[model samples]
Structures are given as structure tokens and as C-alpha cells.
Target: MSLYMLPLAIGPWQIALIVIIVLLLFGGKKIPELMRGLGSGIKEFKDASKEEEIEKNDKKE
Candidate 1:
């Protein structure tokens, strides 16, 4: 089966409710640390992809 390309259906109210739930669950203080870790993980993923693409181009040339 193929994945669909449509955007996720969450509206603004849904987003606000999810944020409220997260705040209640993790509290205000822990969210920043969580976000920082998430950011670093994204950066590492991007760096890895770029390295892989460079390697592919090097092998082709």
C-alpha cells in the first residue's frame, strides 16, 4: 500500500489541546529539554543524509 500525500488533519484547536496535554504531562520545565533533544536529532539526521548523498555522488563520479 502507498502512503497518501495529504496534510495531517489536525486543526488549531486540536493542536492547542495536544499542547495542553503535553504541558500537563511533562510540565513546563521539561519541554525545553525535550525540544532541544528533538532539534539535535533532526540536525543529525540531516547531516547523515547529506553525507550519504555525497558518498553516492562520489561513487558515481
Candidate 2:
């Protein structure tokens, strides 16, 4: 039963490697823009999903 909680761990080296990959993929100058675009897209998706749920509820009512 206790096996489910086996600790999840990420070390500093793993973080550094992820950072290096991001920098190489996006380049230093583009990272911020990419992040902003990602943020906006995620927010838009969330809003669209919520709107659809609300519309469904309204139709049911």
C-alpha cells in the first residue's frame, strides 16, 4: 500500500541539464518570447475550456 508514495526526486544536475537544453533549443534571446507565447496559449486554452463547460451547463439548465 505504501508503495504509491515513493518519493519523487529531481536533483540540481537534472535541472541544469533541462536549462541547457532549453537554451540550446530556443536560444537566449527567444526564451522570454517563447515563454510569453506559451503562457498566453495555455491561458487561452483554459478560458476556452471553461467557456465550453459553461455553455454546456447553460444548455442543460
Candidate 3:
């Protein structure tokens, strides 16, 4: 058996609405701080993954 999934059809208006909602929820002043924290979290996740890969490689050799 196989399962199929359909992707969401998001248009420009949908995107604009989402942006407006986020802006209203987070406010302009907080967006930059949120983005900075998000970026740092992503960087830390990548660094951890790389370290795990290196450890696996070291264990095999």
C-alpha cells in the first residue's frame, strides 16, 4: 500500500495575511530579537549535528 500527500496552495494574499497576523501578534520591535534567537538556535543545531557526525566517524576508525 502507498500513501499520497498533497501540498498546500498558498497564494500571495495568503502569505500577506500570514505576515500581517504575525506582525500584529509579535509587534515590530520584538521581531528582530525573535529572528536573532531563531538564527542562533539553528546554528547551534547545525553545530551539534556536525559534532555528532564527527564522533560517529571517529568511532568507526
Clashes of each: 0, 0, 0
Q: How many Å off is the CA of 50 in candidate 1?
A: 0.2
For residues 1-61, what per-residue lDDT tens digits would candidate 2 score against the true structure? 2665534466788889999999999899999998999999999999999999999999999
What are the runs in model 3 whose C-alpha is more than 4 Å off?
1-7
Candidate 1, residues 1-61, lDDT tens digits: the string is 2355335666898999999999999999999999999999999999999999999999999
| Local distance difference test values of all predictions, in order | 0.93, 0.91, 0.91
Order of candidate numbers by TM-score, starting with the best: 3, 1, 2
- Candidate 2, residue 31: lDDT: 93
Badly placed stretches (over 4 Å) of model 2 are 1-9
The model with the greater TM-score, 2 or 3, is 3
Evaluated at residue 48, the lDDT of candidate 2 is 100
Q: Scored by Cα lDDT, where does model 3 land?
A: 0.91
Indicate which candidate wins on lDDT: 1
